[model samples]
Target: MPHADTLTVVHHDDTKTRYTDVRYQLIRDGIRIWSREGEHSLTDILMTHAYRRREQKH
Candidate 1:
């Protein structure tokens, strides 16, 4: 079995530009089994993570 988690992050640049980041992770047995991260939308990150999980089960 696996567990799923999502996180939102922030970064500030020298030019005072702020960025929001989305990250998704699949963990098993207290360790991270898979991860997807980028500046993408939350919906995209979740969908991609789900697809990858299904593929790995076969």
Candidate 2:
């Protein structure tokens, strides 16, 4: 499980279309800490998390 304050990935779409882009949002403490739009795979969420985790050490 993820810590409520440190990790979360919201996979959602903003539009209805054949090419509708998905969004990956990194949330912490009820606010968005990072976001990426126009991705094709839900896997982007995990990739974002991995990347963010490294940066969080700073």
Candidate 3:
């Protein structure tokens, strides 16, 4: 399983219809950690994890 602190989130919007569908994905080291389809806000996704780590400068 992907480490909670190392996961990065990506948001995508599907506008194939009148309404927009949002997709949220958490990825770690080029691997998909989690994915879901819905109308979730970025703040909602960030708040789900309490121990998120900052991206390291490499």
Strongest candidate by lDDT: 3
Q: What are the runs in model 1 whose C-alpha is more than 4 Å off?
A: 1-4, 14-58
Models 1 onward score TM values of 0.17, 0.16, 0.17
Distance (Å) between predicted and true CA of 41, model 1? 20
lDDT of each: 0.29, 0.31, 0.33
Lowest lDDT block of 10, candidate 3: 14-23
What digit string (tens of lDDT, one per residue) describes model 2 on residues 1-58? 1222233344444322221222334344222332234233333232232222233554
Report the lDDT of model 3 for residue 17.
Answer: 21
lDDT by residue (tens digit), candidate 3, 1-58:
3334333343234211221222334443222233334333243232222144569999
Per residue, candidate 1 scores C-alpha lDDT tens digits across 7-36 of 322222212222223233433312222334
Clashing pairs in 1: none
List ranges where model 3 is wrong by over 4 Å.
14-58
